[model samples]
Target chain A: MQPLVLYVLDLAADGAFERCVRRVEARDAVLSVTDLSATRGDGVFETVVVIDGTPQALEEHLDRFARSAALLDLPEPRRDLWRHAVLTAAADLGALRPRAAIKFVLSRGDEAGDGAGTGWALGFAPSAPPAAPPAPIDVVLLDRGYRHDVAQTSPWLLQGAKTLSYAVNMAALREARRRGAQDVVFVSSDGFVLEGPTSTLIARIDGAYVTPPTDLGILPGTTQADVFAGLRAWGEQVATRRLSVPDLLGADAVWLCSSTRGAAAVRSIDGTPFTVDDALTARLRDHLDARKK
Target chain B: MQPLVLYVLDLAADGAFERCVRRVEARDAVLSVTDLSATRGDGVFETVVVIDGTPQALEEHLDRFARSAALLDLPEPRRDLWRHAVLTAAADLGALRPRAAIKFVLSRGDEAGDGAGTGWALGFAPSAPPAAPPAPIDVVLLDRGYRHDVAQTSPWLLQGAKTLSYAVNMAALREARRRGAQDVVFVSSDGFVLEGPTSTLIARIDGAYVTPPTDLGILPGTTQADVFAGLRAWGEQVATRRLSVPDLLGADAVWLCSSTRGAAAVRSIDGTPFTVDDALTARLRDHLDARKK
Candidate 1:
């Protein structure tokens, strides 16, 4: 296995990347207890998968990163610096394994320090590939306790931004596991189907790939976008729309899409069995793995 | 100003504290990039005020910390060990200043490490006391995006627990500032008054002290509890009930209360003026500062 790689980005007063970015030992403690990232989860992060040394969907990830920062009112991330860091880390880890992931983080800095924010990139390859045959996931629907229009009605609640404050998301996942499921799909209070705790939900309904719209206070799905593009190229229909539980139940197939893990078929939701399309799952995996960018 | 103080708590396999608590320099980096506290905000925390070499409301803070951990499904914090650590840090910090605070944290440990969790205690005194006459705070009522009964209907949302995922709270404070206010009192989606982003709301209504019930998905305020006890001793009425914006607008007086800052009178809500009860504010502060436990 390849050793983990880390780079600490030096940020300027205005939060732009400075010239000196230091490569640090991954085992060293690199964060102060007072850093808002550690103390208050006041940060934003993006994880990009690298296939054969190429960081997949790199620009889209960066665009979403900047968007998240803007939503959180943090400084704009320097794209050039972040790109360099991702590519450098990918190359280092991709040499040891064909598959790797790089996570880049930007925080609101120390509580008592100068105003410059804290930023870092970390790259590592999984110790082993997932189980053979890519087991389908069982998911339970959990209440997210927010209305579908909360992102517009109350921006301070930070519904759409992928901030570091993910404790509730983690708790929901644990709740799913307790109920004999491996994953969760959050439902808004007003009966709209939202995204997964860590992935995007795509349901094939009436012969079209449908995902909940981002305006429903959920993340803009990057992997789902790539999958949609691939589906479009293959002459299949795709869409962004408001999804409800009934719509999901009536779908032909359902899957969760994420960067590193690609797509995983949903075998059951709340114990209602849904047939997994093995051939389609395999095709999507191959498409994702063959990304050149 | 005195230098900061820090202690790293060692944990056993079952997440109980071990005897080898090491005091490290406050400036030293003490957390890994992969600690769940930083990566996912998967943790709980509590802050206790230390006055004149004594930690105030120590047991209550510890109880709340343990309750928060239970909510997050983290291990029960060993009370004896935490008490000792808080006292040790508080003593070190209290020797330098009459008013100081100690924050104790427990995280779900490094993502790649053994299952044992990470824990720390940090003590520091403000460089200077707050402005004389204790300027009252002008607050705006912001939507919390959760219904008042969220804590009952959706425990996985982790509403009442004092978790480290405070980015929304911080953002709400920023929104208050953007709207030309100094602080915020979060209101529920279904028209109920909640707590502040970082403080509890206490209103004097109809000649009685009233606060929202904890069942409304809010933290049970430690300072407010103490103030209630003091008020009871003074032969004043105190009650916990659901509050509304109109209730606040019509209240005789209002205040935001926290452990370290004691209490700050609310001078206004939104743009409407509310006269500050200087005598009551001073009395509450003195009553809080006089705690010996």
Candidate 2:
């Protein structure tokens, strides 16, 4: 399998993308060493699925990307330029791009001096989705160490913003993997169920599908949003609330939703099993598939 | 006046330093776009000072760097190789290398398929420090949103590890700046004094120098450790305690200490002023200077 195919956005001659897409070599100079992304973990990024040669929910991803950049006080991302880069990347992958992930990154440039930021669009097909029925994911509950209201009360926490500082998120996932779990759903220190390291927590409880509110400092789940809309259109009740670990355990069905992975049903958490609701899972999976643009 | 001088450590060909140092251009690929540090912020780093063309406390910094890598479950860094790179970088800086900061970075390589990691040593002199009398800084007290014991109780928190996921720290500094303060002292959610965004906090109280312990998830300050040893040898008492916000505001003096910036006295926190203890600050500053090698 080839490594990441990075397409540099040529912002020369007064910052214009005269050349739209070029393959970035491994040793090529694509980023300044002083980029805050490298130095301070200061950057924002998004990974979207390229479905059948079309980027899925690219505008939403860009919207969220811009929001993240804004939170970091970075200049507004040139959305049209991003759209072009994403489209070129998706198109370059040709017919095999279905289910490929297109990563968009914006870095805080060279902070130690030498002025100019960096942006890139990378396209790569993810390894074939885990053995059909998407294999129910075993998860661990980890503390996020922030209160549910921290995003609202403490703006500096950068809650709800998808910044590049995902070390904690990655650490939590590694911890889960170490404990023989495939995933993790972070619980607030105060005990409210939050979201997954790279996904959003959603579950079927009391005839309604529920997701934790993003006010808890979790990134708003784009796939979850699309799923809720699809479910609502199907005459089903979809809601948001403060959830608990026990609530997840007692739910009829639970799933972690994300842009790339889509609907991954949670079978167990902290090694505790819950009977899988195959019908509910299939319904949500179908709805999620139907929602993809 | 110049950009970051990134000395790449080529680990291919049996982990040998094939190409010792190369001038990494602005657009050069010092890192894979897919490097987890760029993608998921999965990495650890250290910034040590170079005095008279020699990196000070290189061994201590390497020890902490190794500790951080362990906390991240990363492969132990090749310290001898890192030392080679650091020396080459400092020597490359030539006669004016005094007080330059040498940053060492280790990233969890490409997350896609490539398994090799990336390492670099960057040397650059920092901007000139502020004028003498040192214009005591105004600081803001921000909540870090975790109990001080989170490190002890939660192994996955990666507490006290100096990982590159510093977005929160950078944001806190920006928040402080926006609030008309020059720096920040992060307070634990449970009302205990933690540390600063980029430095450790210390205060002069009851004729003893005190700093919040690292068990509180604060990065163990190498400079603080050096200062404590120096002070103890000078017959001054140094202690560790769970301090409160009021402890800082009421102290004879407070300082934010780090390797590069040394010790910067706090004049005010959240608009509350503290009388500067110049005599005490000078004593500690002199001790810190003597300890620097």
Whole-model lDDT values for every prediction: 0.88, 0.79
The DockQ figures for the candidates are: 0.70, 0.61
Q: List the residue pairs that clash in candidate 1.
A: none
TM-score of chain A in every predicted structure? 0.96, 0.91
lDDT of each residue in B1-293, candidate 1, tens digit only: 23388988887633444454779998789888888999898999998888876889999999999999999999888888888888888888877777888889999988877878899999877767777568999999999999999899999999999999999999999999999999999999998999998999999998999999999989999999999999999999999999888998899899999986788999999878887999989998989988889
State the TM-score of candidate 1 restricted to chain B. 0.96
The CAPRI class of candidate 2 is medium
Q: Please, what is the TM-score per model? A: 0.97, 0.93
lDDT of 1 by residue, A119-145 (tens): 888887676777756899999999999
Where is the poorest 10-residue window by lDDT in model 1 chain B?
B11-20
Model 2 chain B lowest lDDT segment of ten: B18-27
Clashing pairs in 2: A28-B28, A28-B29, A29-B27, A29-B28, A29-B29, A30-B27, A30-B28, A30-B29
Model 2 bad stretches (over 4 Å): A1-4, A10-29, A113-116, A127-129, A279-287, A290-292, B11-28, B127-133, B279-283
* DockQ metric, candidate 1: 0.70
Q: Positional deviation of A128 in candidate 2, in angstroms?
A: 4.9
TM-score of model 2 (CA atoms): 0.93
lDDT of 1 at B105: 94
